[model samples]
Target: MTMLRDQGIILINKDSEISSAAVVAQVRRLLGMKRVGHCGTLDPFATGVLPVVFGRATAAVPYMSEYDKEYRCRIQLGSSTDTMDREGEIIKQAPENFDASKLEDPSYVEQLLNSFLGEIKQQAPLYSAVKVAGKPLYKYARQGKEVERPWRTVTVHSIKLLGIYHREGFELPCLDVLFSTSKGTYIRSLADSIGSKIGCYAHAAELERTACGPFTLDQTVKTADLFDCFEGLGRDSKAFLSASIDEGIVKATLTAFAGFPTQAVELSDAIKLTHGQEIKVFPDDITLDTVTFTYNNVLLAVAGVNRGLAKVKRVFTDSSAEFLREGSIDEDI
Candidate 1:
């Protein structure tokens, strides 16, 4: 098989109890490549779609990180946790007479969920990687210290209550909810917010990321299947790993840039782009905020159009195949 060592994005169905970084490390070791990275982080206890980029595709992380995300979350009411998730310590419990049935009223739940449909303020959880005074919030949490977390604005595109269910050993009411949110929206925090609105404490019992921008769960390969492919190669391991940059991954990477307006550039201009040179474009021809320049059917660089000139915002080099910036893909999911 031909080694398509160009650029590609592999969608891995990350399993729970493992950090996103662990998944990336496993893929990096299995693929035997150093230029590998991911787009978003999923908590260790969370599972779902994780897009791992290898080769020149790693340069596209910044463009892919801003995509809206979709998650299927399980929120249990009547108790709260220090970490805002099931893995955290139980910090508080609802009053003895607290009623959880209020969540059962579809109308009431819908109204409450609707309140968060637009932009709202959220405080980073104590257990999150969000930094405070140059230190990770989790560090302070581990030391049993509390610090004031600044509130940030985030948008919740949509929320749908799937159903209300009961867990075997837990007496609290559990809600299965699907959320479509802008990047950086924390489902754990949202669950706690919903609990507060319901007059009971709550925490995220489970979380599964179903989609990240153009990448979806259906496009992901199971972690076990990926390992099987690697181990099955035997003496052909190197060749198989090199050829694993299949068409699907290539397509996925291209899809990440599909939102940008495309313009074909001559070979001369393409070379200029890689050298950080600005190129000329028709002043009135600009129709979008940003444009993707291509040469010979391969995406070369992304540019921001101002006035009549196009400035290179990001350049892609096929030979280097190294990550240009740090993003997620290994921290959480």
Candidate 2:
């Protein structure tokens, strides 16, 4: 079965019990492409919007990773776990006589959730993919060796309590929360901190990403359905490639650079850009720090403008060679 090396992005509504990498791997296998990658990593137990990029769309991964994410997480109070999630071993439990009703108060819950609305520090959990000294932190955790995890400053754009879930046997509260946060904000860590603030043990019992940047759960193809569609495409390589670019299943690579300023250059200048040459732009045309160069509505390159010179930062070209510069630019800008 042959396929085109066409550039595109696909949003997968990842099912629970699957890692983000696994979703990408499945897409890679179905599409039969070697240059496939995911924009962000989701915990194996967590589900929702996983953006899988293939072909030259892989070049957009770094930029897309900067997108803000939204998630709906369930925080179960009164018992804490080693991994700060449902999958971990229980490490602590609230006292039997603990006042679990305090968490049920909507006003109090509102106050507690409000306290975490802005920038906050979070320590990387031991049972996480975060690397320490060239190895994943989870590796050390499995060996019973404790390591000081790095602290990250992440922002919560908005947060609210969706509803409270009370289990019959469980004495404490389970909070269903919906939040929109900056990239790298861990919902699991946030849930753990909420428990800590309540003076009780807590863990993220469930997590579902509702949105990632511009991609939403509604736009995603469920894993099972995606496979069926791939199979349904049959052996027509052209049809397979065309289906891969469908608006519903796959998005154009340029979508990843949405909100970045765009400058449409002449075909000659676009050709020069693809060759890594910096082109001159007018001062009026260089308002944004970074700009995407295009020709005839197709993306050519993303460049940083300095003193009227548009220097290529990332090249998105029809040519086989796609180039990325060293040192990261601020994608949020």
Per-residue lDDT of candidate 2, residues 1-333 (tens digit): 112237778888889898888888888777777888998899998999999988877888888989999999999998889889999988888877877777778889988899999898888888899999999999999999989999999999889888887866677879999999998888888988888888887999999999999888988888787667767877444466577665346677777788888887765576788888989865745545778887655677888888788889887775443322222122221
With a 3 Å backbone cut-off (N, CA, C), the pairs that clash in candidate 2 are none
Write candidate 1's Cα lDDT for 249-314 as tens digits. 334345567667878766556677777789985565664567887654556678888776888887
C-alpha displacement of 96 in model 1, angstroms? 1.4
TM-score of each: 0.88, 0.90
TM-score of 1: 0.88
The lDDT per prediction is: 0.79, 0.81
Best by lDDT: 2
Model 2 vs. true fold: TM? 0.90
Worst 10 residues of 1 by lDDT: 324-333
RMSD of each: 6.6, 5.8
